[model samples]
Target: MIVVLIGYMASGKSTIGIILAKKLGYNFIDLDEYIEEKEKLKVKDIFTLKGEIYFRKKEAQYLNEILNEENRIVLSLGGGTPCYGNNLDHILNQTGVISIYLKAQIHTLVNRLKNEKSKRPLLAELENGDAVTEYIGKHLFERSHFYNQANITISTDNKAQNEIVEELVLALF
Candidate 1:
């Protein structure tokens, strides 16, 4: 089974994905890192150098490749992966692939992302926590539709990593 963890920035997809993979005894892949490796450019660099349109096209291509080839894997996707093109449809239609959304509240996301904005291209421009909070609130509102399309949705608010993994494991089996 390929378990794809999807959620917005700072939603703990990568962190929880590692724990979930360990629990399930599956290999883990972070899709952003995968793209960075393949393109020899960081996601921010890709966006800055080639533009978002190019990045999205390549993102879709790589996502398709990974979904087609991998099995028994825990894949953590970038926040915007599902909202572009037919990527969500691909994940939903694929056999033996379970798409899980790591749902987090706006306040949760703001709190988490405020400190890590430097690492996230999308959030890097915000000047303060309040601004970050407002941005995330609006972003999450827009992205929820795509995220809610996941086969399974797990709330990560006020949840410990292991506890969330336990919940995900329960949901999967």
Candidate 2:
């Protein structure tokens, strides 16, 4: 089985996925890192050099590739992965693929992302925490439809990493 972790930026998908995979003895694959390795370009560089349309297409292609080929793995998707193309449909239609949404509130996302804005292409231009908060509020609203379709939703607000992974294990079993 493949466990796919889906969420907005800073929602702890990668972090939780690593721990969950370790606990379950599954391989952990961060889709962004996988893309970087496979495409030989950073995700931000891909967006900058080839444009979002190209990146999204490649992302969808690679996502399908991973879902079809991998087993006993935890996959962490990019923030906008499900929101683009037929990605969410692809994820839902796959047999043996369990999708989990790591749902975090706007304040939680803002607090987690504020200090790391420079590392995020989308949030890089935002001036302050207030700006980050407002941006995340709007962005999350836009992305929630796709994210909410996950097979499981785990609220990460005020939860520790281990607690979230424990919840995930219970949910999966």
Candidate 3:
């Protein structure tokens, strides 16, 4: 089966996904990393040089490739994967795909992002102060509909990795 992990930035999708894939004995594919490897460009560079639309197009193309892989995989999709083009629909159409969303509170996201903000292209250039909170709130509100379409949602706010993994296993199995 193909387990697709979707969620907002810093929502633990990648973190928990690796663990889940390991436990399930499935290959782990991080979508963004795959793009970086294939295109020989970092995600931040892709967005900076080619712009979001171009990056999204590449994302869709790579997602199509991911679907064709023969091995079972737990794929960690980029935060905006669902909102971009027909990627979400393509994923849902696959009988083996199990979509999971990692949901986190705005405060929790801000806290987690504060220290690692420099690593993310979008969040790194924020206007400071309440900018992070405002951004997370607005972005999450806009993406909630798409995120909610997942087959399962696991809350990561104030929870340890093990706790989240346990919940996900229970939900998925």
Query: What tens-digit string does per-residue lDDT give for candidate 2 at 1-173?
Result: 99999999999999999999999999999999999999999988898899889989999999999999999999999999999999999999999999999999998898888789888988888888888888899999999999999999999999999999999999999
Worst 10 residues of 2 by lDDT: 121-130
Candidate 1 per-residue C-alpha lDDT over 1-173 given as tens digits, one digit per residue, 9 for 90 to 100:
99999999889999999999999999999999999999999999999999999999999999999999988999999999999999999999999999999999988888887778888889888898888888888888999999999999999999999999999999999
* Whole-model lDDT per candidate: 0.94, 0.94, 0.90
Candidate 2: C-alpha lDDT: 0.94
TM-scores of the models, in the order given: 0.98, 0.98, 0.96
How many collisions between residues are there in candidate 1?
A: 0
Better of 2 and 3 by TM-score: 2
List candidate 2 stretches off by more than 4 Å: none
Candidate 3: the clashing residue pairs are none
